[model samples]
Target: MPETSLPVFIAPPLRLPVRTIGRRTFDFSRQVAVMAVVNRTPDSFFDQGRTFALDAAVQAAVDAAEAGADWVDIGGVPFAPGPELSAADELDRVLPVVQALAAVSDVVISVDTFRPEVAAAVIEAGAGVVNDTTGLHDPRLADVVADSGATLVVTHSLAAPRRPHPRPHYDDVAREVADLLARRVDVALAHGVREDQIIVDPGHDLNKTTVHTLELTRRLGEVTALGHPVLAAVSNKDFVGESLDRAKPDRLAGSLAAAVASVFLGARIVRMHDARAAVDAARMVEAILGWRRPVHAVHNVS
Candidate 1:
């Protein structure tokens, strides 16, 4: 028997034209959005609870919106392996902040939680998106997003709640992640979540090693090929730290590089801790790729 070799797949242009999160509608084909990360948890990896206080969280959201962030992703619990947080505690942590931000700003609000109850509560509290970093471990979460008519960001991770897969092995990291996200998208669609409301994330560092995350970034178009707007949350992650041999605070440069690379590779939304920097980088990439026009065109034109 002779073996046949297939050609490598080249992705078509992303078909996600319009994404309506909360009351804001984005033309994904033309605009790349910077989603500011607002962690209301005391143990989040980046800010380390800087915005854990209600006032601080609200102010951070407002500040990010003012700084050009298109969306603000608020999280009540850290995704790192940690002690279990009660659902009520999680609700208390994020609901007030979501309520306050919804009242003050029109930035698309997203709550990073995998709990259906938390997703429902936050949507009722004015959140327009539910970002499940757990890869939709609970199918009920999809139901909640569907019922609320909120957008859903499904990430691919091979871990349960508060559990760690320290060493993960995948034959093809990007391909496997894309396949997983495709399945998740199918589940969401079957559960009544509209196709246009779904966004996919490859879950960088969630259950991957540094090399795996790098490979995923390099081949991000494979994930975007699924016809959904891809979201990359590579802000100050451990993979960036390990790749650059730098500490958490020093990985901003690496994070920015990865974010820009992801956007160039067709990621529509970038989740970042530094909203202003990320917004600048994303806009620069968009402009270079002709997706966006320069603000001022008077440099050297005759």
Candidate 2:
């Protein structure tokens, strides 16, 4: 096999600190954080609303926390082939879940919504993180985050000229994504969001073909150069399905592999469906590379 070109930017040892869940700060030197996905929607791409009821969703969140997730991301809207919910509708669906999770678990709760109103509602409900998949299109979103004092994640999705279903048209995928994230970071900054409160996501599978997704994963280090923590959300995405020659539900193994690769490449945060598996893989890889702490000698107590 031909050798791949070296990535332009690899994630440096420097890890910028950020707050999550109301004043709880995280530093990357701690280890990779696994953000478990909790889709409350009945039409989500994977598992498709397996937890439709409030009780079920709450249990799911709790399970994720018990399973070693650093955070539980709750989303009410589905991203698959379905009609988009209006801002009010989205808020109505998501707020309850966020509130429920916050009520039960201290695990950081991230609300995934592009609507600023929805974001505000969830933040008010005690969500610790705001994950904007539209790359901060809603101007009020940054304000909501600032008011809530929560960390924000900005992700990339190409416009009409270069969307995934229609084949993304990018001059250079990695640099273009990096530039887009930089612009979104500027937007967040303009709205009074602190530099340390920001994280950047490359929006894997958002508007990219299989090749584009792979290229993004391979060159993730370049995108991390934007100078904020990088979050990788490639779990059970269609691109993984294509890469593995399987359906979305059957792509868990491939997703886990990609998640590990993302961490190896420089992703500080990995948004995933199977949190425990991903965490185990990351820990094992870290051990192999001697990234984990050395155990100290202990006296025998027999």
Q: Give the candidate number with the greatest lDDT.
A: 1
Residue 52 in candidate 2, Cα distance off native in Å:
1.8
TM-score of 1: 0.94
Error of 2 at 228 (Å): 0.6
Could you estimate the TM-score for every candidate? 0.94, 0.88
RMSD of each: 5.8, 5.2
**Which 10-residue window in model 2 sums to the lowest lDDT?**
1-10
lDDT of 2 at 290: 51
**Candidate 2: residue 35 lDDT (0-100):** 93
Off by over 4 Å in 2: 1-15, 18-23, 159-165, 289-291, 294-302
Which sections of candidate 1 miss by over 4 Å? 1-12
